[model samples]
Target: MKLESHQFIRYFEPEQAAQISQIAIIKKFNPREIIFEEGDDSDSLFLVLEGEVEVSKRSGEGNNYVVITSVKSNGYLGELGIIDRKPRSARVVTSQQTVLAKIYYESITEILANTKGDIVLQILSFLSQRLRTVTTDYVNQLAYKEKMTLIGEMVNTIIHDFRSPFTGIQLSSSMLKELYPDQESQEWCDLISMQVQRMLNMAEEVLAFSQGDTTLYCQLIDIAKLLQNFAKLNQVYIDFASVELIVSVEEGLIINADENKINRALQNLLSNAVEALDQSEGKIEIRARRKDQLVEITFSDNGPGIPQEIQDKLFEAFVSYGKQGGIGLGTAIVKTIIDAHDGKIFFESSPSTGTTFYLHFPIAKID
Candidate 1:
């Protein structure tokens, strides 16, 4: 059966449904508003007419909340309270501006007396389905957590083993800088030293990620300088592939971010684009502009767009699709790095138009 605009209307005749609608008060909630909290008295059942809400439960220590599920349009909440007359079991907050039908306990009693439909049975079915979903999510989370823990330990061991060799490289680079004392030679030595440190930082980043954490060393970075350095580093590969790299940036634009991490993110995007082009007549464009209080950066490529199979889960770990030698963690790490900087990252792609990634960062304030 086709669903009516009001889900409750499907349970009763037109006249009764009209009465139910009249009795149910329409309520509006703003983003992040708390409709109810865990342990609160439940006097009404909320049926969502628009937008979304997050349902969460207090952690075992009661210090934080863990999101259980999100309820969107045409879904209902507080059904367990209506059926069992118990206090609310979860906290519900609006994820965006929302409209809900608030059906109070007194109104529910009136509907029960008149309606012949199996409303209670429907509520039971909904609850049963929700339970199964929660159980499955819990199991998956547990397994993934265990896997990450193992990865973290392995990463730590590898970093420890590499510590002596990294120290040797650092010492050798510093010695070369001192011995040469010439402009170009010193620059090369400095570059080698910086890259050696960046390698250690990258290893630590992976370890942190495995432990479900992000650590950043943020500094003011010149956007144009960063783009120039990126192009210089990849010039050899770009020339070999016969690809054109165009960079445009607003003068004096600056961003407060972890420079190494952001550079790594750009590298990942470039890698994907290069592999997609497969050394053909490809063009990649990098641009940065200031918008309000944010700095927006775009990386676009004229190549075959991303495959449809992995578009939805592009930012998820291990979601590589239609790529050769892709371990699938690039975009996922990029998202984590951007999120850690309190920035935003997204992409658009199509078969005819190719792919473009957008990154937005909070513009750094200078004294």
Candidate 2:
């Protein structure tokens, strides 16, 4: 019964199992490559020879794939499908570079017809245990989602209620800045005004993101068009300054998201990039492309890059570096907006290489 590493063949004659290996096809898959999808015709049963796979199942009622379990090296897939000659029951996607030994249904049937009854019982037992594991995973995932939803609602309520006080403070600081006549006192008022405005922005961003699905007006928005417009609108600024801006989004690349929110998040990033290069001339490149089932957008800057002081807390609210009158909420807000869309945001930067931020959003599911 110890099946790991093709050792299960002890149940049958070694010569027979070894003969089957000759006809067994070995296939390789790269990271994120889908081996098969649910409902696809199943012609073969696969045995993972190396690496790992994320096994998920899709129900007819839902548009998303619910993770069932992970199958590692030596695990078999589509056994039930092979036995019944039915469609694939689940999807198998590679978590990394992987190799699989595929035995066609024709080969399996031929071997089974000649094998003893115990062989069939062994296969049935393997599948039965796998079914139990998948059932448990689905139940646990549903419970986890429910708990997360409740926590999200509580956070949203708290953040939304904070907006009023932040707004009042923002207004009071603005009035104080105007009323103070002395240069030093006026500067202090300006600092308070800036901080208040930053907090207000943070509160608004948190509130907006916390609203979850309702906050996003999902539509098939063109990614290229958005970046083009962004560059066109900021053309004057780039032209007047001693800096260069490059936009390189592929035409027709689109995603499902809230257009206004995405545009705002990106604008804030660009503005921050420009302001960071205020003293020294720099270049910023915006690039986008299709990466698997997501569109990956990169914003790169050839300035001094993120300073060591604020690099760690760059995405945290209220963390700023040498920039005068900085709120440090821009990147934080950007992250919040992306997270609300079920997208991702990460960056890499150093003094020599500058900085680059990557944003990835799932492709729109066509109904």
Candidate 3:
């Protein structure tokens, strides 16, 4: 990462650099060393000659700083103060053993005073680029906030309007099941009920996770019955004739968790499994077991598997791989809900076998 002064000071004439070198203050830094802090009026601009430094700003919260970006070798530093003698607004700390060449404000002022000076022009270019970047970021952030607010309001309206129709559909499906004489018609009614329930689960997940309405009412969950119900529910949305969905949840396995949230997390995994399957051939297997003080639930699918491009950031928000029309919130919400329950989630995937997601939850002891 060692960089020569010429690379960074290319905007300057050879004579100008020779003049600045006469008053240059070269400083070496160790890892985690601070170059300058916020509000410091030391009045020095720096050129990074080696290593990397993290640039961060003081957060709105008291006594916290958030990282903004990194400055590597050949990059200019403290350009925000090159023109006017303003106090440092951002903190700069060395991320590794570093070396910086510092030029005092007095020297820059001397250069700026020169009628044929290139220093002022270079500083102006730096300032304008910075201003443009900041403005763009601010606009993007504001737009994102606005979009999320609109979506939240829309979800609220949809939730209120959706429940009545869903309830009516459930009720009508129940009535139709009893009245329908043909077995095929009865199965269709059951399918309707299952699809409606899936929609309800998805809507609830969106409200609770996306809208940040996290109010978990924990209850003792029967694992075996839940698995049986999962199998029944999954059969409705997927092509059972082509995909083999096998679930073996041992009986008597119990846990205390938010039933709705945990169910939502598990349903996400099942949905992912179904989606991963090829149209004509795929297999999904679910296994739940208790060992020592932890319960393990695994969902594995035999499909093309997760794309290599997304394996590292698999659970990061909005990082979808190759799924068509995917918003990419499924795994992120799954991780969030599992973390809330004091559980851990991870996955192993490759082109060799399909993808397998593992969920580990602490076993709750019943006195």
Q: Which is the leading candidate under TM-score?
A: 1
RMSD of each: 3.9, 11.4, 8.6
Give the TM-score comparing model 3 with the true structure, all chains together: 0.60
Q: What is candidate 3's lDDT per residue for 227-311, written digit by digit as tens? A: 8877776674556546888888877788878876887888877777777777677788999999778889999998778998888
In order of appearance, the predictions have TM-scores of: 0.80, 0.50, 0.60
Model 1 agreement with the true structure over 1-367: per-residue lDDT tens digits? 1124656556566777777777778888999999999999989988889899998778668456666778888888887776688899889999998998888987876776776657646645766786677667656655666676787898799899998998999899999888999999987887777677767876777788776677788999999999998887777678987898999999888988888888888888887788788466789999999999999999999888988887999998767854777657778888999988989999999989889999999999999
Ranking, lDDT, top scorer first? 1, 3, 2
Q: Give stretches of model 2 more than 4 Å off.
A: 1-4, 7-11, 59-63, 180-367
Q: What total of clashing residue pairs does each candidate reach?
A: 0, 0, 0
Candidate 2: worst 10 consecutive residues by lDDT? 1-10
Screening candidate 3 with a backbone cut-off below 3 angstroms (N, C-alpha, C), the clashing residue pairs are none
- The TM-score that candidate 2 achieves is 0.50
Predicted structure 1, TM vs. truth: 0.80
For each candidate, the alpha-carbon lDDT, in order, equals: 0.82, 0.75, 0.77
